[model samples]
Target: MKLAALVIAAACLLAPPSLAAPWLRTRGLGRVINGTATDIADFPWMASMQILDNSGCGASVISSTWALTAAHCVLASQEMPGAYTTLRVGSSSRASGGVRLDVAQMIKHADFHMSTDDADNDIGVIQASEPFPLGSSVQVVNLPGDGYDAPAGLPVTISGWGATATEFNPVYLQRADMHVLDRDTCRDMMADVATVTLGMVCAGDPTMAICYGDSGSPLVYGDMQIGIASWTRPGCISTTSVYTSVGNFRAWIRDNTGV
Candidate 1:
């Protein structure tokens, strides 16, 4: 129930010491390998989470005060209370051009867990110290209705400000047009690698991939957020990317954060 428990669940490989999420085998940019760059104005809901001072993960604005992300994304901060958690909304650059707001609290799912290869209830909601100044460049995205599941092959787009395969440090947010892959197929592809669960949904793009900063970002169809970026293969192999089902956690979000 406590985030400290998540810190104990960490098991990383080939990853940088500066990165703290449980994105296995991904050094710094496990995903967004060949994604296309875009401006934050196009995806105003994008929340660039900063742990300490560096870009830590991605999130989505849901209200004037709350933003949504992944549990693992904030796990490291649980051990460092003094660490400042900042969210840069309405920013195109990973480190600049956005109104930076310090995070006041972070709450993960009560049942959140992470293993060497798999994670469950990975959702997290963070609150800013004060309400964000909402506008055209800073807006909220809608979540899927309770129990509304994203079916296989549903088209979706994921956005983040992570490193690309060509640019180790990209300045603009990246978007990957992807599609949902049924869980049965996802489990088959991830065999011996991870354990797929009802709590998670799978997606991928044949010609694109995600990056390190993609973790905790939104997986959207139209204006609805259905998933939260979770994990992927070591090199975005098969372009397979996993995300926490925002569609599956409506009550959890309301009960936990009143969002």
Candidate 2:
């Protein structure tokens, strides 16, 4: 019965053409439900991207010169080359307290599409205008080594400063604990809505999810980042969310940014 409910919700995720998708397409759409508020002391690689046309999204610092995010996020800004003007580093609060730096270049996967109603490459990169000053509060995250896939049932953590609901946006960052869902299982459940791809991963808890401004956020296991927040059901119907798999894009990342 519970699974049946999820399928029904998934089918209607993009029911009407008016549905805002790619998970939190507008500024007011993002938030973390059932998450604990935290600070920069923990997620040193966290980045808050500020885009002009929409509520900004989250990102992960992969190298001093580059950060990784969802390509759709860049597309939302309606700009090419460099989309957003600045990004916040080592900050937990979205509105204050962080070293604001310029964005040098914005790169998105060429094959990515804005809708998750089907297959989506869904990954992109942000190059800082200058090198980030690495320290206790600002550091690059460890990338997945070689070809690695997170096994099903593996616990993961995701953090962001989005919104809790349409009526609530959090000032501080939030983190939630979840686990990887089996690829086959995820595909089965999401088939009615999205076409889960090899380059994507699915994860969530019955009570945990990323929303509105949470796109481009990182999904990590220990110090290794495995996924990038991409999409979820509309209206925040389910905690289950789809992510861009970092493991599947190693060659692409190396080619684009040499990270």
Candidate 3:
């Protein structure tokens, strides 16, 4: 299927537009909100991959030995030699007892097109050198599959240490509550995309949207994770925040990453 068509079909059951001025710009500093683990040490896989100093990307643990993130995050590195050499996954707050697993392999979504707005198959998996310790307090998020579908209007939780506002990446993690948007509503919101397809899911309020730093963060609904923050329009505050729907590609993801 075409990228736009995939986004529409993938999100045919999902649901974007006004914008509010960004409140503040966080410089790699994240806030630990309520319900979040009290100690930074608790979240072992909630990491920020550093390309220099900025939190260029975010990733979540999906299995003891694998992590899920955006395909774009490792595309360049995979294409080149030794580009992602220092990539690390651990608490963005600091490096302590957290494991620094080398990215033994990277698998990008075949349909991902970096030049286009469509994020078809924008997902990717990073295999860690070692399995995350079972009782290490690092919990792997379960992915949505086998008829998993979030009901419309359901409230979902999305967390990231990305930029709090526009043009900046936060230093600490933050969580936001968002509602799922159906395909029709999202298409209208993504009117500029030429076409909205079946591989994408839209989330967040029109006024409060995910930003650049949030790419690859999990969009959790209930016990299953359904989406990954993939991209936002030119302005992060735009009503439509495109996500790579996990449910739509569950089989493909499992096959490629062997998770």
The candidate that wins on lDDT is 1
Q: In candidate 3, how many Å is residue 118 off?
A: 3.5
Q: Write the per-residue lDDT of candidate 2 for residues 1-259, one digit (tens) a residue.
A: 0000011111122123464443433423333456777888799999887764223678899998899988866665444334445788877887677788888888888887655364477788989998887899999998996567778999998887655743244567878889999988888876756778888888888877766667788899987899998777655556477888999988899999988
TM-score to true structure, per model: 0.87, 0.86, 0.76
lDDT (10s digit) by residue, model 3, range 58-162: 677888788887776656345533344223455545223445556677788777765544446778887777776544546677787744555668788676655
Q: Looking at candidate 1, what is the lDDT of residue 192? A: 58
Candidate 1 residue 57 Cα shift, in angstroms, is 0.1
Clashing pairs in 1: 29-212, 31-210, 31-211, 32-210, 32-211
Order of quality (TM-score): 1, 2, 3
Q: Which stretches of candidate 2 lie over 4 Å from their true place?
A: 1-31, 53-55, 80-84
In order, how many clashes per candidate?
Answer: 5, 6, 26
Best-performing candidate as measured by TM-score: 1
Between 2 and 3, whose lDDT is larger?
2
Scored by CA lDDT, what does every candidate get? 0.72, 0.71, 0.57
